[model samples]
Target: MNIVIIGGGGFLGQKLARALVARGTLNGTAISRITLADVNDPAGIEGASLPVETARCDITDPASVARVVTGETDVIYHLAAVVSAHAEEEFEDGMQINLFGTLNILERCRKLGTAPLMVFTSSIAVYGGEVPDPITETSLLNPQTSYGAQKAAGELLVNDYSRKGYVDGRGVRLPTISIRPGKPNRAASSFMSSILREPLNGQAANCPVGEDFLHYYLSPRKCVENLIRTAEIPAADLGRNRILQMPGRTLSIRQMIDAMSAVAGPEPARLITWQPDEAISSIVAGWRFDIHADRALALGLAADASFEENVRYYIEDDRPGN
Candidate 1:
């Protein structure tokens, strides 16, 4: 099987690439080649276990997208996007990448007539603005932010394309992945990872939301696992919708801090300062933190066992001096 992963430069994308390479197979088929495509060359992306390739493919450019995603490509995981806060700040750029970029990929697959298994990484941000208590597959999408709106549109594109038999596509709505091991970026949920990531590194981090604030989160490990699982699931089993709401644990900042204290110590926990940022607070305030994600669970996608396990996973895997 030939597989291509867009946004392979990012942490989650790299993790998924590594996992795919490690397994050396997908859906019981031996992977012939894995192309890790991004805007620039993906740094440190080497797959020792399988035949790997890297290319600089800009998603906004159809030619670039087409060059990498050819007729021979069997699976594509489209994960490139401008993050939530960044997308809100740059609306045009977000639409260019999130909306039009996805359109480009779908169009390419349609031209191929191959009906490749395309997996899109949508976000929980799609469920903002007057959401149900437990957001489900049947819930109405009412995105408030520009990023959310773009993702919502992307999901529609994936669904419509799959319905037309252009691609065997799956749109996965990812929960906020906590304890992401990397430098903080413009994502509104970056703070979720930073609160634990920075403090553990002995650097102070500001918590923009209050301790009472709630959100759904998964560990980076499970996030990558769920991404792979989305592709592994048969299209017949997915039905027409082809969108799965990825499962995550619901918890508050206070609970996360408590878990950190237990795993590391109170000193690192003390490094966290509760100084609110209105921009971030407003961006995430509309999010539905207590999502049930029943369909994904039933589909065999797993969630983080607990918040404590998340914190510990960070320490074990990405922690310095490990």
Candidate 2:
């Protein structure tokens, strides 16, 4: 089966691409080829087991999106987005890429009429303000940030398009992925990674949120694993409900620091300096991410064992020069 990964230039997309290539199949079918499309050209995978094509795709431009998603495409992993703080800062760019861009992809899938499997990565930022401690399958989406609102809208479109038989869509609301390798991007949640990554690298990191701040997290390894698993789930099981919240480890900023310190010792923790940013804090405060992902668990998707395990995964799998 042919596949496409939009935003394949980014870390998560590239990791997913590598995982797909290494696995050599999806939903029990051997992958014929995978087209990695992004606003910037995705890096080429050296000595790939399958044909990995890299292309420049402007998801905002329907024509550009259409060029990659053809009749032969069997599965589309739509990971493209402007992110949280970036979206909040640049409203038009965010709307164009996050909202209209998703519409463009769905439109292309509709034109195919083949109803290809489309796995859309959503965000837990969809839940905000007042929410249940354990967000259930029935919880309402009241997004406080532009990024969350856009993602919520995307989920609806995916569900509606699936209901219309235009696409076999699966939407998974991802938690804040922590311990991401490399430098932090513009995401308000970037501190989730930076606070751990920089300190472990023996560099100082500024913590914008307080230690008591609560959030849900998942390791990059588990995130990729769950995404693949999401693709394999049967449509019969999902039925009319097209979205599922992926399992995540709920922890506070202090607990996260403690986990890192547990693995790497107090030296890394010492490098973290507390400096609150109201803009970042306000956006994060609106999100109530505590969740019990019953649907995802029943489907055999699993969360990381602990924040400590996540720390080890990063050091071993993604730390610079590891």
Candidate 3:
């Protein structure tokens, strides 16, 4: 099978590419060629176990995205986006990349004449505003942030295209991926990792939310695993909806800090000091805190058992000097 991963340079995107290359197979199907496309060429992917290709393409530009997606591409993993905080700060850039970028990919798939399975990495932000506890697939979306609105819009487009037979698409609504490696970015959730990562290296970190603030989460490994699983699931099983509320563990900010402290030390926890930011708190407050994920669980998509396991996995796999 030939696979194309858009946004392949990003942290999660690179992780998924490495996993696909390491496994060399998916659902008993052999992976023949893997194409990694992003605005910047992916780095540190040398000595891959399988045949790999790279391309620089902007997902926001239809012509540019089409140039790389053409020819025997069996699967497309759409992981490109402007991220949450940046989207909220720069609304126009967020809309252009998060929403229009997805449209460009779907349009390219339609013109291909061959229905390739498109796995879109959506966000939990899609379920915002007045959301019910344990948000289900049936929950109505009322996104308050620009990022959430764009992602929700993308999910709709993916479902509509699937219904129209333009592409075999599945939008997996990802939880807030925790214990991410490396330095933080512009994302509001970047603090989620900084609180753990910075302190481990003897640096200070800030906690923008209250200790009691609740949110749903998953590990980076589990996120990539669920993305691959979504590709393997049968179209008939997904039905007309084409979107899945991914499995995750719901916990508070304090719970996550405690888990990290247990794995690392009290010093790491001490580095995390509470300092609320209204902009971030306002956007995050509207986000869905939990999900049912019955459809995803029944379909064999897996998630991390707890916040503790997620933190431990990060320390072992991506810790500095490991």
List TM-score per model, in order.
Answer: 0.96, 0.96, 0.95
Off by over 4 Å in 2: none
Q: Put down candidate 2 lDDT per residue, 250-278, tens digits, no spaces.
A: 89999999999899999999999998899
Name the lDDT value of residue 258 in candidate 2.
92
Error of 1 at 160 (Å): 1.3
What are the per-residue Cα lDDT tens digits for candidate 1 across 1-322?
9999999888888889888888889999998888899998986455367778889999899999989999899999999998877788888999899889999999999999999999999988888667667788888888888888999998998999999999999988988888999898877788999999999999999999999999999899899989989999988888768888899988999999999998888899889998889988986787887677888898989998888889899998788878
lDDT of all the models against the reference? 0.89, 0.92, 0.86
lDDT-based ranking = 2, 1, 3
Backbone clash pairs for candidate 1 read none
lDDT (10s digit) by residue, model 3, range 103-182: 99999999987888899988888776666676788989877778889999999999999999889999998888887888
Could you list the CA RMSD of all candidates, in the order they appear? Answer: 1.4, 1.3, 1.6
Which pairs of residues clash in candidate 2, taking residues 3 or more apart in a chain or in different chains?
none
